[model samples]
Target chain A: MTLDFWGLGLQAVNVLILVWLLTRVFWRPVAAAIVARQTAAQALLSDAEGTQAKADAALAEVTKAREEIAAERAAMLASAAQEAEVAVQAKMAEARAKAEALVEAAKVAQGHAAEAARKEQTRQAATLAVEIAGKLLARLDPNAVQGAFLAQLVAAVEGLPEQDRAALTRGGTLVSAAALDDAGQARIAEALGKMPGLTFVVDPALIAGFVLRTQHVVLHDSWQSDLDHILKDLRHAA
Target chain B: MNSPLDAVALFQIGPVPITQAILTTWGIMAVLLLGAFALTRRLTLTPGRRQAALELIVTTMDTQIRETTGAEPAPYRGFIGTLFLFILVANWSSLIPGLDPPTAQLETDAALAVLVFLSVIWFGVQGGGVAGYLRSFASPNVVMIPLNMLESVTRVFSMFVRLFGNVMSGVFVIGIVASLAGLLVPIPLMALDLLTGLVQAYIFAVLAMVFISATVEDGTPKSQKET
Candidate 1:
């Protein structure tokens, strides 16, 4: 039995051709697909890692911002506290100043009231002294006082205008504290000779002096009139 | 019956005689080439079930090549993977009714062994140089050169004889058993033949890889031998 040399050559050629065909169709393509899948997986992993890093960075930024906000909030609280303290201090000072003003004003008002009361007392004391002087003058000797009053009256009459003296002489009455003696009356008439028609009238309320009266002319020269004028000046001073 | 050792020509093309083995080899080649094209038509990064199974086969081939040779699988994948797939399919082709497996033929095994021998030389030359490939025969010392050269031919011839003997014996024994006993009696033997076919295919592919790598390693400088 002989070997089939032609079949052997043909089988070897067939296998060689199969190897070349399978290389292109099977082996290379499958290996390439595996490589491609691996590459894609690697890319996805890289992207995921990048995203994680970004998230970490963003978290760090947010944390930093939160810390800053906390610090800012603390600063605001401190500032508010400081401002509140200043406002409280200012309010306290204002209240204290107002209280001081009220107290000072009250003291000033009290002092002014005391001074007014003292002045009032002084006016009252002056009025009482005038009244006492009036009483003391009244207790003096009536005739001597009368004479002195008449002398003063004559001197006042001589210094008067002619019309006044004539009006007194024509119808004027001499009001006296008591009925004057003839000597006093004659002396008064001589001193005021133009007033011959002067009448003598007794008015004890005059105290110890006289007033000469006419229709429009009256000369007051009495203790009561002097005391009344002193009282009016004291009232004005008060 | 014609001897399994003999390949009687069915026809002739001028000086070349076309036998049943050649026709069967052509059918196997056509089926494998067309089937491979169809299987790998739609390869993608995301794989379908078909693509996954295909990738599994290629990956397994790469692993075996890597494990056996301790070298990168890319350069040897086509030659080594094709040898294993073709031999396994050819060995199992005996399952078809009335068809003898192509590996059972002495000439087919011899042709396979001759291709392995040629590939060893080719790969050796590519690894180092022509001078380096020639020098690999004189490895260890000049005295071993003649023995080494004779051993190379004998080793290849032994691989051919081993494959032919196992496949032919299984087929011949099954034929005799079927002729002597009933049809069902040969089933276990046929099953054993299937196991024998698988083991022989594996052994043949591994031996081819070892032989090729031995030549390449011997020819190459120690520094450049990493490839």
Candidate 2:
């Protein structure tokens, strides 16, 4: 068969018309719809990614908050412990001060008690010597001895040295003796009368010895007084 | 020239002969059209036997369109399916006794080529603006514009010649061979002709897909990159 160019051209025109009709009727809407669906899908994918990012950020924040709360709790506990330690220290200091004050007060009270005991012992010794001397003098004749001793003590006082006699005359003396007989007492009184400044008084509590009290001097001749001096020295030494 | 077939003398307009090949082809086309019309008359969602067969063909065409165009096949499904079915029928018609394939004619082959060409232009214009569609001819580089335009024209010409030459050669060879050899010896040739018919139909469909894809969007070949 021969190739017919003219017929082919006519057929080509017919084909062109058919294609135009088909595109207008069918293809346009399908293409548009497909593009729309793809756009929607992409938008949805992006939205999901955004949501996931937000969730991740929120989770991180929550974790941070949890850690912060734990740190705060630890700090609070440490502060509480420090406060407790301070309170305990304060109590301990107060207790120590009170104990130290009580100890000082006890020492002062002990010193006061020791001084009172020493004064009491001295007063008891004086009373005991006076009673013993009285008992010894009662065995002798008290009236006879008193008269003789007075005359002797008067003579002795008259014979004393001028300075000593002068001091003796300034203040009267109290004399206590128990060993002197009546004659001896009288002789001592005569001697005291001869001395210009001498004077005498007698007491039987001296227990066989004499004691003289003067303005400037006290001569201790009582046996109980001597014994008390020796006993005090021994107690101190011991 | 001597009469080519026994039926050549039947109709004449002046000096030109109306051969049996043309008559037989027209008759076969009419019958096929009538059969398709009958099958498609009452379209149903749940198909009967004829509709089921037609649906299978449509589905296959839909898949081809999707693979080539990279879009939903539903939109171009009907038109591409119809075009394929028409070409398949035309090509196979040659296998019938005393019937020539309509596509073996320059007019028929050129018609299909022009259909592909015009579809390319129409879809390109629709997909992008007229400015964008014309810009495809200047692709790769601006200096390539003239060459690109020549290629576009040549591609259409190739479509025309390729289908024309292949179909015409088949018909020519079969006629010459059958004319020389009697019926018994020509059976193998006839079988080869049948295979050619199916091959030509497939080739035409594939070429149509290639042209259609070229016209869509900026007409750049699809890239492997994810959308």
Task: Give the number of the best model, judged by DockQ.
Answer: 1
Q: Whole-model lDDT, candidate 2?
A: 0.62
Candidate 2 per-residue lDDT, tens place, B1-227, comes to 74331233347545544444445445644565566556556655445786556556555666777777687675455456545655667777777776777676666676677677776787667665576578666666688889877776678678767766776777777788778886677778767767777776777777777766665645443351234
Give the Å shift of residue A231 in candidate 1.
42
lDDT tens readout by residue for model 1, A33-125:
877888999999999999999999999999999999999999999999999999999999999999999999999999999989988898889
Candidate lDDT scores, in order, read 0.86, 0.62
Model 2 per-residue lDDT tens digits across residues A1-64: 5554445554455344443443343333333344455577778889988998999999999999
User: Comparing to the true complex, what docking class would candidate 1 get?
Assistant: medium
**After superposition, which runs of candidate 2 have C-alpha atoms over 4 Å from their true positions?**
A1-3, A13-238, B2-29, B219-227
Best candidate, lDDT-wise?
1
